[model samples]
Target: ELKVEQNPLFLSMQEGKNYTIYCNYSTTSDRLYWYRQDPGKSLESLFVLLSNGAVKQEGRLMASLDTKARLSTLHITAAVHDLSATYFCAVVDAGNMLTFGGGTRLMVKP
Candidate 1:
């Protein structure tokens, strides 16, 4: 079975601050993805890290993958109210199914 875990399940930040969210998974897979979701909404794809050392950035958010360690990271830069949301990292199994992390909820207060 695959398991994904995220740290600092809840975060409160001030505007213009930065923080990093960590995701760790059990098992081996090079396919990992990051997503964002708003309250009472579906997830929006943020980054798709297909291999080790793969990194992608959009706006104030960045994501990276390290297949070797079965780890992924989502970095938030210059937090803003609009950026407050839940972030998730998922790992794909051989069957192409994903095991998602518990999710990290970020609240940016101005």
Candidate 2:
């Protein structure tokens, strides 16, 4: 089984819209992180999912954690073209190695 994976590798989104991205893992983990990257740009922090029921938001994005099921989620609300970017969710295993999801690329239209 894949340690970490995200669905819909590419997302064609719209301005002033809302969407949800899901991340799944094979085993239980405590540390989860959500990061954003724009085209030709470096990574930026959006939220960090640490434990069960942990939720955080910034700007138009929010993230949640569910350690029991080894799942995390990033939810985007009222997206704008400026929100166009790539989103990644990562989880740290027992060995302290961060395992990254395949990533979701979002393209918001004007």
Candidate 3:
């Protein structure tokens, strides 16, 4: 069985600061995805890591995957109030089932 864990669970940061959110899984997976969600909105796909060492970035957000370590990271550069949201990382198992991390709620303070 594949299980996912996210560190911090909640993050509070000041504007212009940088931080990294981590996702660790118990099993092997080649496909990993990152998503963001606002308070009451549906999830929005942010990144897709298709292979080991895959990385994708948009705006001030960057996501990377290391399949060998069963780990993925979402790094926020120069945080801003508009970037406050909940983030999640999901892994696609051999069975093609998607398992998601617990989710990290981020609050960017001004």
Candidate 2 residue spans exceeding 4 A from truth:
none
TM-score of each: 0.97, 0.92, 0.97
Query: Relative to the unseen true structure, what is the C-alpha lDDT of residue 65 in candidate 2, on a scale of 0 to 100?
Result: 86
lDDT of 1 by residue, 1-110 (tens): 99999998999999999999999999998699888999999999988999889999999988988888888999999999999999988999999999999999999999
What lDDT does the true structure give each of the candidates?
0.92, 0.85, 0.94
Q: Per-residue lDDT of 2-108 in model 3, one digit per residue for the tens?
A: 99999879999999999999999999888999999998999999999999889899999999988889999999999999999999999999989999999999999
Predicted structure with the largest lDDT when compared to the true one: 3
lDDT of 2 by residue, 1-110 (tens): 33899977999987988999999999878788888888788878777777799999888888888888777888889998888789998888888888889889999998
Cα shift from native, residue 52, model 1 (Å): 0.7
Backbone-clash count (model 3): 0
Name the runs in model 1 displaced over 4 angstroms: none
Error of 1 at 30 (Å): 2.1
What residue pairs clash in candidate 3, if any at all?
Answer: none
